[model samples]
Target: MKCIMDDLTVYTPSPPAGQNALVVFPQARECPELPPSGYAPLRGSAPLGRVMLRDGRSAWAVTGHALARELLSDPRLSRDRSHPGFLAPEEWSAEVGTHGASPALVADPGDEAPHRPPLPYLTPRRTAALRPHLQRIADRLLTGMERQGPPADLVSAFALPMSALAIGTLLGVPYEDHDFFEGCSGRLLRGRTVREAATARAELERYTGQLLDRKRHEPGDGLLDDLMRQDGQGSLDRARLVTLPGTLLARGHETTADLVALAAFTLLRHPEHLAVLRAGKTPMTAVAEELLRCLATPNGILRVAVEDVEIAGRTIRSGECVVFVTALINRDATVFAEPETLDWDRPAGHHLAFGSGVHECLGRNLVRAQLEIALGSLFTRFPGLRLAVPAEEIRSKPANPTSDGLLELPVAW
Candidate 1:
């Protein structure tokens, strides 16, 4: 409720009605790789504490690693944005209301029964099918970066393009139209206002539908064609057909680009495995896994109680919002020895970077494959890779508060 601030006792809402004082969600971040100082004290205090959102609403923050994972699989907690109790931040609540219920980014497949999506698109076997394609893209990007010379922004020249092209190839979207969807993803991911996000969402929807129409006339090998087959079988309707690829396009690429950049940034900072990477001593698969564990986004995921539930001697009322802190879960000292240190040999399975439960990321396999290829080719080709600017000069704050991405990752090879 109330956080200690150097001898000052500030009360949120005055606590006059006998309700607990609310803790504002954040304060300052002393380290770019870590959470804010204000948040530091809350998790240590209890597994579930009251967190006040902007605009005066409050939610419970799940602080413990075991509890966070348990609750993620608890059917009582729902991520359905359409739910009135869904604790979307005040800024974008209206934007969510503008869209109807579907298996879009707002909810998973079978959240609506009629929209159950085909399962094989991202299965491990199909993901393996994309490996060679991913390698080619990585090689081409590296060659281009080399020609452009040292001191390049990895986010723009490699990470961003690799993601865009990979998702494009998978979805059968034309390579020439990457700029269009990429602009939409930018607004939707980092737009300062709800209007910008809503406009971009609508435009992307229109474009996806038009592209599918074109695909029908000139059939190609895209996962969308799989959806088209389902459409012919009365399994997928037009709206579900359009929403899925748009969801994949927007949801798949940007955070992954940010993540790949973060992985490269972290490796350069530690450099413990720099020589190993260049010499091909450790497998790239292992290196990528460690980077994933060390650099996954440290943020809370929001879910709302669909019904009353009791846990840890507390009753969470229906419609109440719950947040599971991912950082605390992934970096628990008891579970992970020297939790902050990266060890390529350590087994880091079941990590929550892609989240967990029924809503676990559909792109997990694609991302893992992409990371292995991208990070492998990146450091191997440029053995002299290092940050162009000092690490401290790179500010950690993301362009959007909802994300933990660096705006630009400047580096040299």
Candidate 2:
């Protein structure tokens, strides 16, 4: 592949770090362009190489399939955002605000601090308790759909609303507040201006604090209430409980909603797979896993090196930011035969869709459950379901590397 650059220098990895690093660039595919917010892969290739980021700083874009996997699991890489000089290049840094740094980045690999429970409110016990409530929400959503009739946009009518409701119910937020939460989450993730993101964070924090206060005085049958009890027990702190639930509410819905929409889109695009799924004999479990793998994002995981380390023969200097492209690794032609082809029955091996290390997504089970029920019920409910708009015309969010917001997925009975 021809490498393109503007004021960027490319470096080929020396012997043993694999061969020359292949530099994937923008314009490699006909898909929607990436949002201008964060660093993400533009294309795929072999080995490691240096590229000048838009800020005029030398950065490494590790593109090799094997090398990306190796680097992702390497302990030398850190996910802590607090490391010195760790922000994106100067140009990018000027656009974002820094939050108080966490000790995660420099903490020892064995340290429990970085691996602290992601959500104090959504504890394992609370998650189990919320199951019946979740089922009720799912049932209500399906019932509403049945009464409203089909020929609806699943993205708008079913997937988005249902996800928002489930996440909100878990966090003690009313379903009516979906639009507010959605806007706040979107701004936090994709805001181009630092001030915008900071404003959103403050608003979210204030909202969560009020909710927590309500839970303390008049507890609801929700995770937030359970967190209040945990706090009273001294097992959780007030600040931790408040902030964690807000983060959970933001993360819980959006990604799963996208996955459900994308999985439907993928199955519909390949009618053969749709037929297999509709047979009702083959378990939906396998199909869900395959969809997760196939739809893996190109951006991978971000981590900074805590110390100088040698890997695959090359020495990685401390303080360098390393990104592992899971999307590229999952599709490695060597590990997965006919990687680009989606096989519903592909045998499960280790895939990085949920990530590899301790930081792997804690909500993996819930996401799988949501996808299974949502996709299965959707296909079963609307046998004639299909896309409303032309595939080429689908609108996506700016700065997002994956499928766009899936505008108006009209489906029919």
Candidate 3:
């Protein structure tokens, strides 16, 4: 199998004439926790090589740190899902592909909107302003946990709901409607079927669209209200004003919530690291950064080549898809000393946990703020917290597109 680039360019490049092809793709039903052993086979091969996906689609996979960053930052690559041959992982490819503009899909009908301005609400000063409120939320959740007693699944009780509430507060979404938004957003992010995903997306849009209109009459101090004002003043378009909030609402909760659960799980597995936090020797910021690097979710970032470009001795033709295996890239041995170990004191270097280039995540500051507050409060409050189940028994939910998160994380103090 081979990837077909734009204009029917079919290049059957050999594996260095004498080298065998590297089977770097993860096998079906393989455990996600166990990193793929593909690197061993690619030792003598190029950093970028062809790998057959689980669905038998062949595309290029970028694993090396240097090459990953180069390709990610390259303008020749495109994030527009409409572009043909843009290989999304099997699970999410269908949903994303259908949502693109070209085919008049209901989810994202018009052309992808021009990039919006950096969220005016997420300024450092604003985040600092919101820090106390965030802490109060964290404290309230922990208090509820204390009242409810132990053996609680942090994913549902703490991580999931807390994340939802934080984003809801920012978007001016009513607290009473969080359950509906959370359910729809979960399916939108991780639904098993395209129909499931599309339905969830539609429901979220309907709800947010209504909320956006409501704010016009009774405005509040939230991003939604701000964007609504811009739209009313004609600075923002209707399509963007309608869709942007939904994107923030879903993504804002999904990724951060997963990080909270995963960070907790990582600390539980590495008691020595947990001790660092428990002893209060290392700053929570440092610990959060280390965990972010180490447990960088195994979600693969997808891109399409917009124009022919030579990278790493290989030509990525316009229209071909590329998968930057960030989890692999973050753990590259050359860039990170002792990359496997969790060291809070390790000097920070560029990591693609949040991605790179012009399309880097917009919510990063908000994410960092939430992580620091959530993790800082959780450990500080419950010094005796430990997993209710054995580490090996913990199961990860399938990557909804690229997010790898826990189904439940049972913990007790």
**What clash count goes with each model?**
0, 4, 0
**Native-to-model Cα distance after best TM-score fit, residue 406 in candidate 3, in Å:** 1.7
Clashes counted in candidate 3 amount to: 0
Task: Please give me the total number of clashing residue pairs in predicted model 2.
Answer: 4
The lDDT of model 3 is 0.68
Question: lDDT tens digits, residues 203-274, model 1?
Answer: 877988999999899887778877787679896677876676556655666667867887787778767667
lDDT by residue (1-413, candidate 2, tens digit) is 22122211233323225433333221112232211111233332235555443344445556455677667677778766557634332223221223211112112122236535435444566666666666666677767877888656776667776666667766677656666876675565444555665576678778888878766777777666766776787876767765654455445555676667767877887789889889976677788887777666333455678888776566668987665555555665666677667787686445667776666776776676677778877777678877656666554432232223344466656
The parts of candidate 1 lying over 4 Å away from their true place are: 1-23, 26-30, 90-120, 179-184, 187-203, 398-402
lDDT, candidate 3, 341-385, per-residue tens:
788998644777888877677677777789989988998888888
Residue 103 lDDT (model 3): 15
TM-score of candidate 1 relative to the true fold:
0.82
Which residue pairs in model 3 clash with each other?
none
Q: Where does model 3 exceed 4 Å of error?
A: 1-34, 37-46, 88-121, 175-180, 187-200
For each candidate in turn, give its C-alpha RMSD to the true structure in angstroms. 5.7, 7.4, 7.3
Give all TM-scores, in the order shown: 0.82, 0.73, 0.82
